[model samples]
Target: MSQSQKKIHYAWVVLIGLIVMVGAAKGGIMTTGGLFLTSITEDLGIGMGSLTLYFSIASIVTMISLPIAGKLIAKYNIRMLLVVAVILEAGSFAMFGFMNSVWGWYLFAIPMAMGSVIVTQLAGPVLINNWFKKHRGLAMGIMVAAGGLLGAFLQPAAGNLIASEGWRNTYFILGLGVMAVVIPVVLLTIRMTPQQKGLQPYGMDEVKHNETIQVEKTANSGVTVAIAKKSSAFYFLIIFFLFDTSIAAFNQHVAPYAVGLGYDIKFAGNAMGSWSVGVVIGALFFGFLSDKIGVKNTAISAMFTGLVPVGILIIEPENPVMFVIATGLYGFVVASLGTLGPLLTTALFGNKEFSRIYGLAIMGLAVAGIVAIPTYGYMFEITGSYTNVLYAIFIMLIMNVGAILLAFKGKKKLEKAGLWN
Candidate 1:
């Protein structure tokens, strides 16, 4: 094919791979698995605390796996890695069907967490950074939004399957489905770098002909992983990730919060679905906005917008319409995890050592999973209300805006010292 005929960039193919693979891993497995929680506990006659501890175990594993996953991604074939990742993740999920004891979950949580770190957490950001130089934010947003869109349907479907076929069959079906769909997509579309396809990343026409020049240019604009690890910018990003994850953990408590307010379980599910809608819209909006107004500004706007939902939850929790709106708005802001997080990293440090740096930064997410969820639950247990937790989230939201500003300031210092080069 001539150049004109071959004009469809392969970065988009990689993007499609990312969307399908990550979305399936997240929607098919991670997001919808909660539907099986009550069923599994009830069927197996396990305590809720005992059964749920497996998720905690998975979080700890995820924390330890992030940096190791990053190094492996840098060294291995992207296609092969993702294929193995999906099998481990989805396969273990399928295995959950056969176990009569809670110990099975604890044992399988190891591989589950490992596989998930690669497919769900690492792949989308790393691959997008590799494949798209321009419109990177938009690409990240689309990937995240695709998960939201998929989960919007998948959650309901999983719920119905659990209701009709029992949790065991539903577990097997979801695991098999994810592996069937995601592995093939990874094989077909994913590549470690544009060079493998003899092309440049999207929006890299000016540097298309020279790989050496491309590397040099990008390296000069960013700090190395070593320098970034020692810098305040890095610490600030970690703090931001922590607060972001902690704040968003409130989503898990939303159903309970609603039930506390006298809403039925069905309404809670519907309300959570509304939140998914916000996720889709916000992902796209923040991505496009980051491209237009820049990452820093877009982040500040998100933090400000986040306050609205928290306020609604605090002051008007009983108003069903407002509750849905607030939850949706909160999900919209949560889109930042998929959108702003990576983009901000790139903006602050460039793409020179992006995978390594991002891998380290996201440890905060894993840590939050361990700390935040239990903290929220504990606070509610002690206080008999989410009022304190909501107030704390409000303060964290404000702190997030400050962290963004401080991180940018740290970036300026790095640039001034010529450490970026």
Candidate 2:
């Protein structure tokens, strides 16, 4: 074989490794966190509100760390950054096993959030954008699907572990497992870009340096952050994210919610697993659909589809089959949000300063996390039911639909003004 044929495009390999590490870490943390909530509260003799506050602290930390983490990733070596991130994330998680009080959670949540922001949120998008030119959206969708798959498997397993071995041992085992697997993967596979391996992105015959230049020029043509902030589109996008994220807060609570409804913990875990299955299917389908149709249509469809599950939950809380269907359908909306959220930003604003603008816009997700999780928890504490939150989610779903419409209006305004091409 010739040198070109023989040359290994290791970036794609790196993408796969990153996907696994991200999947394991996120699946362990986000999907499994609620499994421990009840155990932690009962063991420590704490109120649900108090334990939920730790989740709030984690959100605030996630918001604070994101921009700093973005800047660090840009400035530092990717390998070193990931190493630090894994240590913080997995190590903080492991430390949860030893905690005797709530204060431990509040303190350790800082590092856990910091690490999570790096691995789960930043690394996938940045690395995929750097490595693949031709099928970036598909790459992102696959990466997210991997995480969902892992969540589908791990959530039930984690719940079973907690049921049998107890929460502390589960935390120790999971935390160590994430660090052990991810650290080595990051060291061995991940790199900054394809250029580091002296190759173009997968499937490219030649590097179109000029095409890249033109695309950059178009992306940077006129949309400034200042100008973007002035548009109704920006605010609409924020509202859309906030509502969408608030609805997504349901995932964290699914296991506990199931228990609240008098189901077995294992059954709850399986339901959450079903949720991830829906996420996997939705991410792949909606991602491809967005490419075929338009981001606007895809997003509007997703927001409306999200409402179906809300109705199911409201009307049929006691039926396990209905609960599973509702959570799974909810997962479909979430899958779209994961894929379409960034795509919509790029579609609406172009990619000139995409990182900065995307970073700022996604802070709305953190804001939603900060408000939504605790609010949901407290509502349950006060009302002994999620009915109020469900009603609120329905209202927010309507608002998200409005937000998408407004974003299109803003896009038209930009195009008419010759500010967007």
Q: How far is 85's C-alpha from truth in model 2 (Å)?
A: 0.8
RMSD of each: 2.8, 2.5
lDDT of 1 by residue, 1-421 (tens): 3564457898998999888997788877876655565567668897545666677778899999999999899898888998999999999999999989999999998899999999999988988888888788899999998877777777667766777788899899999999999998899989988999898778777344668676557643778899998889999999999999888777777766777789755566677777777888999999999999999999999999999999999999999999999988998999888799999888888877888889989898998878876677667767888899999999999999999999999999999998986
Candidate 2 per-residue lDDT over residues 1-421, each given as its tens digit: 3576676566669778877878888787766788888888889997777787877898899899878888888899999999999999989998999998999988998899889888888777777766766566777777777778888898889889999999899999999999888888889889987888786666454446667666545534547676778788888888888888888887877777888999988888888888888888888888788778878998889988988999998999799999999988888779877788877777778766666667777777889989998888889889988888899999998898989999879978987887764
What is the lDDT of every predicted structure here? 0.85, 0.82
- For lDDT, the strongest prediction is 1
Question: Which runs in model 1 stand beyond 4 Å of their true positions?
Answer: 1-6, 38-50, 99-102, 206-216
Displacement of the residue 417 alpha carbon in candidate 2, Å: 3.1
Candidate 2, position 293, lDDT: 85
Per-model TM-score on C-alpha atoms? 0.91, 0.93
The lDDT of model 2 is 0.82
